[model samples]
Target chain A: MERKNLVEMVNIHKWFSGVCALRGVDFSVGYGEVVGLVGDNGAGKSTLIKILSGVYPPDEGKIYFEGKECHFSSPREARMLGIETIYQEAAMVPKMSVMRNIFMGRELARFRVGPLAYLDIPRMEEESMKALERVDLRLRSPHAPVDELSGGQRQGVAIARAMYFKSKLVILDEPTNNLSVKESERVLEFIRELKKQGISSIFISHNLYHVYPVADRIVVLSHGEKIGDFRKEETSVEEITKLMVLP
Target chain B: MRHTLLFTLRRALLLREISSLIMLLVVILVFFALSPLFLSRENVGVVLEIIPELGIVALGVTMLMIAGEFDLSVGSLFAFCPIMISLFVSEGIHPILSIVLALLLSLLLGGLNGFVTLYFGIPSFITTLGTMLIWRGAVLLISGGWPPPFSSALPTAFLVGRMGIFRASILWFAGITVLLWFVLERTDFGNWMFATGGNQVAARAMGIDTGKVKLANFMLCSLLAGFAGVIQSFRLETTLPSMGGGLEMEAIAATVIGGTALSGGVGTVIGTVIGSFLIRIIDNGLVMARAPSYWFRVFIGIATILAVILNTFVRERARKMRC
Candidate 1:
């Protein structure tokens, strides 16, 4: 099967002051595929994602998005290019409503009636509702403050927000870190839906079991080096675990 | 049938009270209980007048606070703004142009605070704290140890003072507050301010540009401070170097006591009004009751503590209920 590459990293070198965080790492995520990124605590999952999400530019490396090399000074620049990131603890504002969170930085302004820049609240509510529905959750109120939602619900909202924005590449960092069993399943199911939309994703997790079922290709990183990349049908969870722990 | 009944009972809650609304009730009750003079026609007029200026200051500080930032220089800026406007007006500059320039200058001041904080990655609290001192020094320098000739330039009936039904100051405050409320509750940018302060990291991830939000908030805060200064100059018919002395601390206290978390992400314009009223009433009552004027500070401090405790307790109970 032929796979089209959506993202490619070449010799990505990142350092914290002088200490090396990522050293000469190379990897690629294919288009329309769920790619798993597994590693230990210091395996540089966050560093890699930050570089990709434009949180921190790599010290030295080439990042190509859809066959063209690029560098982003900030997350907003990255987002404009259809790349979105959802960190475990930092994805949605707790005080903002579900619809506001869905639109957040990106909102559709209504036809300017006069001096006021009116928000198309009805349109936002409609869009947010459909986005929530895609995750199989019916929202009681579009105006529900995110802080009121439980852990599972918050995660659901985060995923839905990312999807609603029509991102081509959605990066999930430890998506189910603090979630319950059911919530984890909900996340997995959403990843499948992303597949149906042909939106590529990079799912980072400490747990190999969680990633295997959702991921089509598992890319194992240990101590910031790409150890192995294996197809789901070709590799078992045991092999992925052994590769992670042994390194 | 019993389970359904219990479920319905559990689902009920005190309608989500805007923190200010709840505080306003407490303030009215306490003031009314303490003094009959509080409800007098003259005192009512005083209350109405005072609430607006504080409301204007609160609206801007509310913006800064809601963005998870602080501005301790508003009082100083407020003093400086009117002095600048008076100076410009005295030079025969058009009042409208002078107003625009004053507003722009306020924006520049705010932008400077924001640029330093975001670019250097400094906490806004520290940046504003430093800026407040600097602005206060500048205000003193401009006054040249002499009070501004505010009386000569300002209108006694229009800008400076009022008679029977209306005061220029009251109208000024009301206009600003209405504009602020419209900006805060009716616009998308207003929503962004809340979200930015609520979770800086999350706002950034969502491409909300938390830096820009903070800058805008700071600018708005200073603009309000400046606007109030003009009205105050008119009211006092003078601008002393110490005109808006400690107004920053007062505005911040009012905001916090009104239920805005000093740490940011939760606050309201209405809440600040209640907070301002609480502090102001306490000031008036303490004086009427023959209490030490110094007690106002202590009362403000205590109110801050109570507001935080109340907020935490309410959140905890709400969490437990969910469980």
Candidate 2:
């Protein structure tokens, strides 16, 4: 039985300064399935994902999220459709406390006094603590600044935020980049947690070893085109690496 | 138990304003010891009077600095606003109506500053610096480079009247501070402001309109500066072309001394008040001590630098003490 697709990008084309970045690429991610997107530098992987995540408009193509055709002008629009993208660095304010970072734009407010709404600090702090715990990050306090957290822990907080928001599909861009070996394993464990919760993920990475273990299916891009797509059991790691390296 | 005690002490001392608070105390004590008249009721009143005018302007600067913007135009607006009001009042408009018109004029000037900074994508310092020069020059052209004298009986009595030891301007300063403090600490807009200043990219990623937050802060900064100028002019019954000259730096200094980071995202309104008061007290003490008036600027520069250094030392030590 074929799995239902949560997101579908059909015949997508993108260009920049008369240069083709993506040419007629078709990609889809099924519900609760991990699709590892592997490519060398300048292989159009980043452009394709940016289009799907609404960072840029596709020159030609249609995107369907949850079977509904969607056009997103900004990342916020994509996020509203339950798609959260965690770019490398986890994209958090360093000076703000962990809890504040978790609920940065979407703050919980209580007791409307005239035109002002007081922030519900206790509730946010409690929820932030639980989210951090769910991702298995043991920080000293929710009040600690994000800059103090280890790289792995920071990624965990981003994952925890996505999880708590109940995003249907999360796109992790180089999630394990610059992380320790143990930290990479922790991120792998997080992907497992997402899978257990019936959420789909698009894991983009340069390392085949990292992608091969958790991916249900693999998609390879080379020189601005889709080169290959293979199921985990059918394709060997060497084959995928060859597809990535040899255009 | 001992570990917890050390932890608690470090945490308390590590706050951005604690060092400033200690420094303020030391300065006041030193002044009191050096001069018998430093603690006199009349001298205390003098410090209180000067503090509120600069303090009100500093409050607005504190928020803008935290939101990661600057308005050098504040000093210019402070000089220009009252002149505009007196011009209208002399032209047969009621003083009340003139004040209203002046504030509206201030809003327009502020909006212009904000628009150029946001829409054109120029740094606020450059935009406001341009505005500073424009408004100051405009005031000079309008007033013929001379101070204008115009007084309203009821308005002056109400705004500058003595409320026992403290003046009405001091009340205005304190009231505005409390209102702003609540807004900064308790409101969603306040949080967004911090996020915008702390990290614009991340804040935008989180779906915040950082540009809007910054524009609003610029407007607020101008409005407060204008309001402070109106109050000062009403009390003095004259709008000096030189009035508020070099005040922008003083307000910025007060903000930095009060523990607000020049980089933004880390400041408190109360801290700015203390910072403003500290500078005022020092200025007052220096005058009473018969120090050269230029000594005031020299001391302010030293205080600002020292406060930041001490605050950083305490913060780093606090982090190190933590497990």
Candidate 3:
């Protein structure tokens, strides 16, 4: 049986200045699939995801989303197509309220006259609480700044934002880094929640232990090249770790 | 029960303007005690009249600061706009047209400042610093180091005319403050400003045009500075190249004292309004108390430092309480 692919990138190549970052990398995510992208430092995991998320355009390749060839010039354009990328340590504006952070780029305006419009604060607040509840995150108020939330909670907010936006694919780059043991568990649980909703995600991580439980398939990268792609049932954590570290 | 009490106290202290408000009250009380004439009607009116000039400028600076940028060139633009207005009027342009033209020039200069800062990837502080010198020199060259004669028959009464005990400029200041407050607190642009200032990387990753946001703020800051200069010139009926000299520092000080962070992403126009009044009152109170006018700078310096320290301490406490 052939699974339907939600996103497919074929022979993607990226170069920064004169240094090659990715060389003809072919990656794809199936419908309702979680792909744990594991690689060592400088293995091009981030570069590949950055290309898919529209942070950088691939020098040579094509991206097909839902069987349609797509071109993205900016991150905004990609987001408009139901692709949400949560970059590590760049998820939410710390000084802004949770509700504001949730609706940072897409705000609900009561009425827009020219460029001057009032925010629909009541509706935003109500929706924010509902989204947080979906992730089991209860706060005293939606007005509290995200800076006050714990590390795990911040990731929860980003996940909730992706869920609320009904994103077709969420690419999380190193989402579990810098989190405590318990907090990492919560983030893994979020990946499960995303999968339950039939939302596909690319979970990039250096820790195999963290990714093994949540990811349905594991893809290993070595120095800008895809070395192995295996279903979770057919691969072990030790096998992926060896592939990531082998020269 | 004790935790609830601590939480309430921390929350109150965490309010952005509370420290500045407390400082304003303290300064007012100390001045009133030292000199009974500090609260006299005439002296109060004098303070009110002077505050709008710097207050209006600070309001713009506060907005720009919240967007995570700085404009040290505002003082130069303040003087430059009015001089241009005077030059236009001398060239037979209608006073209204002259004012509008000068304002447009201000917007252009501000946009240039933003363009240079963002395009070259330089700090706005450095970018505005260079433009500050350039604009100041332009003012000197244009005005020839003297006050340009402004037309007294330009129907300026509507702008700076006296209404009972208050000048119309005061009303302008209040109106601008209210409008900007709404824009900052209730609008989508306001949220973008906070996000852009708070974390540029996060904002960009979220698909916001941080460069555009900063550019808009830069233009706005210069426009307000120019407008403030126009108000002053209308009141005085003259334009001086040296006018608003050193005013950029005063406006920055006012914003800092009002709890606007130097690092950006946190600030309020209302706090800036209180901050402006606080600075002016200190200046006027020293005169009323028969103290050297130089003490005004000393007091402002002390007030700015104290307000920041208090705000930081309170904010740190609130953060700890949350955990």
Candidate 4:
């Protein structure tokens, strides 16, 4: 079987202020594969994902998506290229409704009538309902304030949003960070579901247990350098944890 | 069945505008009971007359507040625009042309407010406050601390003339309210406004230009403020140097009373219209009831605090009910 890369970063480097966040590092995710990126604090896992998400451009590197070299100047540009990023804290506005959160920047507007084009409320509500249904997440209403949702359900909403948008690569930055044990399991299950749908995911987390079961491959970083890469059958959680702790 | 009832009840009280509507009705009733004169046609007309200028300015402030920004300069620009118009008209410019020039200048003022804040990375509150003082000083200097007189039947008739018992400014106010309500409620741009204020970083991540939305809001605020100034001047047939002073506070208070969050991202145009009316009617009603001039301000202050307290309590209940 030919193993093709869906996303590839070649010798990426990043610096914040004067401190180096990511030294020379290379990372990739294969099509329909869940790549678990694990690291301790200050390991540059976030910087790498941020680069991929277009939160910050790498000071030095090349990024190829779907076999095409791409330069994304902004997160919007990155999203337009089908790269969706779910940040830990900033995924959705708390005060806004779930439907509004689903269509925040990419709202569906009715065709222009006279000089005005209005929000297609009914269509958005219907589509949001369908998207949430795809994730098997049931909300009291699509109009419920997102702040009212449990941490786990919020992750579901974010996942559903990416799935509905047909994103090629969904980057989950600590998707299960603050969720309960059961909710964390749900996120892991959702990742497996994504693999079944041919959608690739880069699942970033600090917990090996959270990522190990669902990930097809585990990538480890220590002090901003790629320390270990292993297939599920090639390594144990103990070994990966050791790699993350050691320089 | 209990779940559905909670949802429905939550929706009703959680809606900020509905509460404001209730407040407006209650205020009117109380005022009418205290002074039968409050409900009289002539007294109602007088209250209506006081509303358009204050309401227009408040409309601009409400949108800016919704976008998570403030424009203290609106009142100064409101006074300045009329001064500019009167100066131009006195110098042999056509009244309509003078009005247009004044409005164009107002757009610049608005742009400056947005640009200074964005460029310096300062809070808009501070930036607009600075501009407010500067523009107010500019108005005084240009007018020599005196009101400018005018006598133009055409400009007056067009901008502020009576249509039956109501002034033309009231029509402009209603027209603006309708237009802004449509923009805020129905348009994609309105969604962007809420998103921008709701979470600017998230908004930017999703490809929305949060900066542009806020800048446009600032400009719209100034344009409306200028329009109010122009209307008021044409109505009075003169421009007072003291006009529009302290009006920014009134506008901000009204917007908050309308349930626009001070932190931004949540507001309604209908709520703001009711809020504006509630504030202005109290001011008029107090005068009719023979209260001292200073008493109205105390009442306004108390009313604003109470309105916000009431709104927050209701919203909290709804949130608790949601769980």
The segments of candidate 1 whose C-alpha lies over 4 angstroms from its true place after superposition are: A1-3, A10-26, A56-64, A67-73, A112-116, B1-23, B26-30, B33-35, B85-104, B144-146, B156-163, B286-295, B318-323
User: Which number leads on lDDT?
Assistant: 3
Taking the tens digit of each residue's C-alpha lDDT, what string does model 4 give over A92-163? 888889998899878888877664578899999999999998888988789988888888899899999999
Off by over 4 Å in 4: A1-3, A113-116, B1-8
lDDT of 3 by residue, A212-236 (tens): 9998999888889899999999989
Give each model a TM-score.
Answer: 0.87, 0.97, 0.97, 0.96
Chain B TM, cand. 3: 0.96
lDDT of 1 by residue, A156-246 (tens): 7877877787888999888888888987888888888888888999999989989999899998888877888899999999888888889
Which numbered prediction scores highest in DockQ against the true structure? 3
What are the lDDT scores of the predictions, listed in order?
0.78, 0.88, 0.91, 0.87
Could you give the candidate ranking by lDDT, starting with the highest? 3, 2, 4, 1
Model 1 earns a TM-score of 0.87
User: In candidate 4, which residue pairs clash?
Assistant: none
Docking class for candidate 3: high
Clash pairs, model 1 backbone: B20-B271, B78-B225, B160-B234
**In DockQ, how does model 4 score against the reference complex?**
0.71
| lDDT tens readout by residue for model 3, B255-296 | 999999999999999999999999999888898889999898
lDDT of model number 3: 0.91
Instruction: Give candidate 2's error at residue A20 in angstroms.
Output: 0.1
